[model samples]
Target: MMKKVRVERDKQGFWTHPQLPEWDESTTFADSKKWFSEKGLDCALVIMDGDLGEQWGNGEIDSCLAWEPEINIQDAYLVGIWDTEDGVVAMFAFPQIILEDSDKAAEFKTDISGWVSSDGRFYGKDERLARYAGSTHRKCDCGNIIPKNSYCNPCAEKRTKEKFLAMPVVAWDGASYIYDENTDKYFSNPEELVEHYAVDDLDSSSAMLIVCKPNYARQIEDDFWCDDLPEDISFDECGGVEQETISLLNKLNEKLKTTVLSYSPGDQRLDQSLLF
Candidate 1:
């Protein structure tokens, strides 16, 4: 995957691409089209909140990029910056009317799928998060109206990295883990912990970054890696992860339902449940 040039927020809490011309009220649809074409980009982008993208995706608004007479370009920019999901996406559109006739460039939420995103990520929450210190709006520490008690998502990630680097020990796979004070041992991964205790201990009060499979890892992240998991569960990305997890869980569930344990508790043998 090509690395995405994540846009940074200026002091005013605004995100601007160094390569693209900034859009203002005086700008026009022709201006937006020019911005798209100048970058040799393929299309125009709209990013409004809620059902707007859904409506457009289902083909409800084919001619939604309606222009206005006074400030088509400026209002579009304001609406996008002030309120929207995927701020400043790209699109391939031409005004049906002449440049002078329309006031706005894109009157509705635009389709981001048509935009030029060389990066693998779809430009929405991820882009919005990155634009404002891993936050969604201008109110955050990066650029938000109200400051939050907890660190923004990106800041939390930085904190996690700092903790990981500061750690003095790690398991064979090189992952960081918490020490079991009672047992006087620490596990770098979940595979070691699961066998030593009951199933509930896997995700109990103890928090850790667990690697179930080579490609699958889940971090019980909160204040610290050892902090309790958040009470309210929220998904990070659901586009395809939901299906992928469902499939993987089904396989794991099938095996668990069929497999039988041969070793009793505390047996001096390999925990063969991992083999199944």
Candidate 2:
């Protein structure tokens, strides 16, 4: 098995050692530069103890502090770091390795325990290879390796809920439901809010009306409103709307009348109307 150390750029803008937080806090990249140019590093070389075996696999992994060799660090410059599940990843502008010939056996191999370098070398034990090679391992802002996307699962879910709650809605008969024709799912109404909403809230309403920018409707999935009506077809001819929905639509238009500056009766050509 190989040994790994967690490392990150500290607030002072220098990579900190995993085990020696105090030492990292005491020193900075300036010290590392001095070690390379004027003096030499006399510290114990941080080495991994295990081997990744012959099978180097797909590079995606949890974010982690990689054990970097002093030689590699000498040529490296800090670019920017992002928070990962493991910790803050100390990114470098260059010093990236380029993999050349790859062994057929190792070419398609993928592993979570180790990182693969750009040149196709497997650094199962040495995580530095993963960072240098730009592995697919995603890091959450909280500093942990997660699945492919940016936020960890927990954070992602939380964000989604927060975003949903902030969406616009309508309040009727003590229930709030916003129609999302795209997903055909109801989200909280932005226009009006209740303490909490559920599927039951939607069931309470005889009919629901979804409102979205006409042009943006298509950007959402499964929104029928996004479908362009037949050329010259008036709003009345657009079918599928319930009588209740029509009543609510009229009410909404009445409300809009107070705030809207003007309404245009554009030419029948869909393209011409859409432009404005």
Top candidate (TM-score): 2
Which residue ranges in model 2 land beyond 4 Å of their true spot? 1-136, 148-151, 165-177, 180-276
Q: Cα deviation of 56 in candidate 2 (Å)?
A: 39
Q: What C-alpha lDDT does candidate 1 achieve relative to the native structure? A: 0.37
* Per-model root-mean-square deviation over C-alphas: 25.1, 21.2
Residue 16 C-alpha lDDT in model 2:
39
Following a full C-alpha superposition, what root-mean-square deviation does model 2 have from the true structure?
21.2
Candidate 1 per-residue lDDT over residues 74-178, each given as its tens digit = 112221222133332333232222121122211212565322122223344343322333221133445423222234665665675466445443233443343
Instruction: Give candidate 1's error at residue 240 in angstroms.
Output: 64
lDDT of 2 at 159: 77
Give the C-alpha miss distance for residue 117 in model 1, angstroms. 24
lDDT to native, each model: 0.37, 0.38
lDDT of 2 by residue, 167-258 (tens): 45432322223453223444444333222224336432323234322111112222344456556554556575577876776676666645
Q: Pick out the ten consecutive residues of candidate 1 with the lowest summed lDDT.
A: 97-106
